[model samples]
Target: MRPIGIVSILREQTPAPDRSFNFLMAAAGNNTGNLLFTHAVWEHLPGPKERIGFQFDPDKVNATCRAVVFPAANWFGAHVDLADFADRVERLDVPVTMIGLGAQDHDFTGKVDVPEGTLRFVRAVAERSRSISVRGTYTRDILARHGFRDVTVTGCPSLYQPLQPDAERRLLENAKSTLGPTLLHSTRFSARYRAFVDTPSIHLDLYRYAYRTRSDLLFQSELEEISLLVEAAKKPDIDDALIATLLDLYGAASWEELQAYLHNSARVFFDIPAWTQAMTGYGRAYGTRLHATIMALNSGVPALLVHHDSRTREVCEFADLPSLKASRAALDEDAISKSITRADFGKFLKTRGRNQETYRAFLADNGLL
Candidate 1:
């Protein structure tokens, strides 16, 4: 178990590097797999091996480490000049593998914003890397469209640290039946999309909302605001109910009286596991937020998605997971009802599982596994 040095972004507050380095090192490749990434990703991965971090010097790395792994798009400070970074790394004369996070390629409507200076950066990235891995097929297609015929692989990090089917399945099996059809929303709702809601049939904006989820996902929030001034408000099915119930899972309360009980539920709450346990308590979920959808799926609970932007859509599409238009029009009672009633629990699992395996195959093919 020779040590490997992983270069990734972190909060600058990690206690110390642990098994994650080895975990990443193996899954990414012989050269790619030995490194760990704390990029725009999960906080931790556990392994039984000790690996060095930046705290160690280059000489120590060259002498004892196996190879390096980097997903330079850590979503951090300063724009990445891909060419320059590639040059700097190549100059080290050490083996390298790159995880290309092209997650920003497709919007909810399946369109993408070709960010300024991005193509050039990717070319530079292509020019420098020994190998490349894209997050999804959509991105892989986009890269192909751009003439990036380099050795690009398709692997989704959301499915990178794979979970067991049994583990996720039991979560759904054990979920309180009352929590069915989990509706998940993030605090990520934007004000711009709100403007579109005020003018429904006449004004069309959802297909171009860019970063807003289809209006249907936020039914609870919408209804709450609508209820403040209306006679009879709309009711949510499993899709719409997930948002409220998830909040309920977090002590928000199932009903008003339960809301009061949760006010002091602090007396019974711990920080971390409570959140994990709460997350595990969903049977089926429809989410507008990426991680919410991710956790639900990883937990084996059937999850449907509402896309607010390209990132969400690309991720789900890459994983071959399903997403419904979160457009305001789609959020109406009829559409929402149809989406919920037509919810294909079997398809949700089958599709994402196939995608997960595809990602795994990329890893194996790339020598990461």
Candidate 2:
């Protein structure tokens, strides 16, 4: 059977000849939650194994095979440049079906006023596709205003696909009963983007509080520290506090020493199952990394999301994820307890089921599966 083409970042066959360059690219791709989620969706697509693979090259897409599926994420965001991307997607002559697509607002405002480039890309997708699967009501409403009503709210495919109806029930039961002291904290501390924002104080606070409380915090997203450590050695102009915070967080005295510790310890996880499995024994997980928290939730660990941006808040609100705004998330015992205690996984599970059904139906309607 001819494979259903996925419009995603497929692994490059011919990697850069430079080993360090290829290593960084691989890390960047794996560190990105969307890419991981995309791989999961492709892995679980309802079709024969031989009938699905990434077709990012537009010229390769033709009517001889199955329809193209562009899986979900915060694709429509303020920071993204979509003009060339839209043109490339449009070049595909075959049918396109977008699943769990979302728009991101950095300021957390619900209202979305996208630029022409974004509008052009959206219009192109709308024109080519039978229906667009959106992340939540927020995206649905946003796209509706933009004159694209052929949209369905399917939530994130990563949260729903490989669906387990009993997963949430099990997680909730665990939360109420044998919840432990080990906490899996998924952080978003990227030194590559450190200059953009102040590293959301709540994340730092969580690291400190979780460590001091002796709750055994297993931190994810160590690539940023790795990046900083590498950069600090090459250039002396790097921020002193940035270096200090990383050292303090990881308990490393120097960059050279931290690099060795990181390599030896193997702290960063690039694979989804590896990351998800690591969260299993944890009592409760909290993190600003939205997908990491979702992975925890999907894996039946009682989890809470510390939302840092509009994309995070949208998913939390849309899916009823137990969440606190990073701006207001106080690291007090009462506050933490309240956030965890009030998490309604039962409600979220129902929503997840419905969204999964809606998404599958969207694919079926588009002749995808």
Candidate 3:
């Protein structure tokens, strides 16, 4: 098997000189989730592995690998320069398979119109590749409208990752019993974005709910790490404006108090193994953090997603993972308990297995497997 080039947001470094500061900040939370699917694609394909540089050079990449794999997300958003990315990818003559691509939306149900730049990118991908793997029905439909019929509705790769079934069952039993008081609440409050109008309020509501309920809130995004670094006076590159914005978004009176609060009642994770390790004793996990909920599900813990936008909602709906819309109204413990009890791992895992087969077929049909 010839090496296949994988190009993605692989956040494999701290002081990443290759990426922009904004990209690095976003990657802190997104990289692992993206890699969850990318790695699965790599293993599925016939290849000796070669990670293509984030800096896309067509001739150099083509010379090294048989094909290129792009694990994409929310490609229909306004923030990314899809035109530039398409232009660069167009220069490559190798086969490209874009897995788990999606479009961002303002709400859980509404769809954002795809821009010309995004359409161009999709066209370029369609021209070079066999089929594009999408996140859900919404993304598939969006591409269909733009004349891309080869799109496959493969749910995000996070749902199909490896899990410890026996270990998870024991944890679930503990949750069902009275021995576990610990609840995991995942929230994302720090990011500069324009698509979701209710994201900040939704996060604030989740934070308040976690605080009132005494749940151990978890932070997965880079902003959490950035805040920790700034507090420790370790991130010398961060500007005062960025620090002020971060502090304001953190919703704390002081940096020390924020640190104290997190240290006492919250936990931060940088990788999957440590995250699953931490999930062992927790009774339930609930909040807007999509992957965090998925991680819990994969770990055998009952979890619920507080879906604030289209991406989370569609993925949950497709994968049969338990989820609810983001609301400012307070959610009582009784309601939370009901949702947790209703989470059926047996059903969800069955659906996940089926979706994985479909995803594998998609890769095979495209000549990757």
Candidate 4:
């Protein structure tokens, strides 16, 4: 029987000693958060499979594989460059399926300027599949506008990563437990988008809370944080300007204090299992990174998402995850405590089960099951 071909790096192929930041970024598709869903998709698909790169040959793939699967990210946006990927997909002859594809925008206004290449990519996949799995209603709506109605809102494959049958009950129990020192999945400030204007304040407040409580800080794609980790590991000459900028941004008291936090409290993981295992130590997790929060939940740690854009917000709403918008979130000690306490775990469990069934049906329809 022919195996399916997955468009992802299932695990860290690069050895630890030789893994530079560029290699890590490439393995993660430029963001460490991508590992969550991509790994989930890889896990859920049954039978034999081969990991294929985007530069694959159509003739070889059609001859060797039954189908090809894409565990996609926020591909529907003006900023994404998918011209080469679209061309590759267009040439593929085997059945194609995409899971957890999403549209990125500042808000859920349904006004996204998708590039022509991305549109072509969507069409090519749609042509070869029974249905396309999307992250939320926003993504479904975006595809609907392009005249593709066969879309399913599966939230994200990452939500289905945990193997325990009683995972939802455990997650609920964990959420109700007394709060402890939290893990902050931090995001840095960016001026490239309008939604990022509120990022600094949200991140600063989270950083201050983490500092006061002695909680660890987790970084995903931020270059400055990665640089600090690289410096610590390699013993390189420190970038003083980068440290100063981060110190100011995060409201650290001094360079020494910031250094202490970086050395002791900051963490970046290149491996998915290690990252999920680390989340188990934290009583709670909250931040702007969606997959980081999902990782915590997968570890039976309660998590709250502070969503800044439609890409994050739509999934939170669809999955029934505990969330507060960055614009409306009050990050004070009392507010944060209340937000975590007020999350409706019962409702979340109910919605999660329904979404899981939908996801399984999607896979079955696409002949992946």
Q: Which candidate is the best by lDDT?
A: 4
What lDDT score goes with residue 59 in model 3? 83
State, as a TM-score between 0 and 1, how close model 3 is to the true structure: 0.83
Predicted candidate 1 versus true structure: per-residue lDDT over 71-116, tens digit per residue: 5332211233344443344344345555646545323343444543
lDDT string for model 4 (289-347, tens) is 89888888777777889998899999999999889888777765567667777888678
lDDT of 2 by residue, 1-369 (tens): 767776565422222323352354344453546645676667757674232343245775664555677665686766666686577667877777777788887776767667778778778878788878887777888788888898877777777645334666677787665446545364554544543234436666665565455454443445554443232222224467667656666445586775564444333344555666666666776768777778778877777888877777877887888888877776765566567777788888877776677777877788777
Clashes of each: 21, 1, 0, 0
**Per-residue lDDT of 1-369 in model 3, one digit per residue for the tens?**
567787765534353445454555455434344444554555566658677766778888777778888777777766565777677788888788788898788664545666677778888888888789899998788677678998889988666677766745653464454345545554454444322223457676666566555567776554544455322323335455545544565555665665566667776554456667878777777777777888777777778787877788789889988777776324677777676666665667678889989988888877777
| lDDT to native, each model | 0.43, 0.65, 0.67, 0.79
Candidate 4 segments exceeding 4 Å error = 13-15, 163-166, 189-200, 230-238
Model number with the top TM-score:
4
Q: What are the TM-scores, per candidate, against the unseen true structure? A: 0.55, 0.80, 0.83, 0.90
In order, what is each prediction's RMSD in angstroms?
11.9, 4.7, 4.0, 2.9
* lDDT accuracy of residue 256 in candidate 3: 63
Colliding residue pairs in candidate 2: 3-51
> Which sections of candidate 2 miss by over 4 Å?
10-30, 48-55, 111-113, 163-166, 184-189, 192-200, 210-222, 226-242, 245-266, 332-338
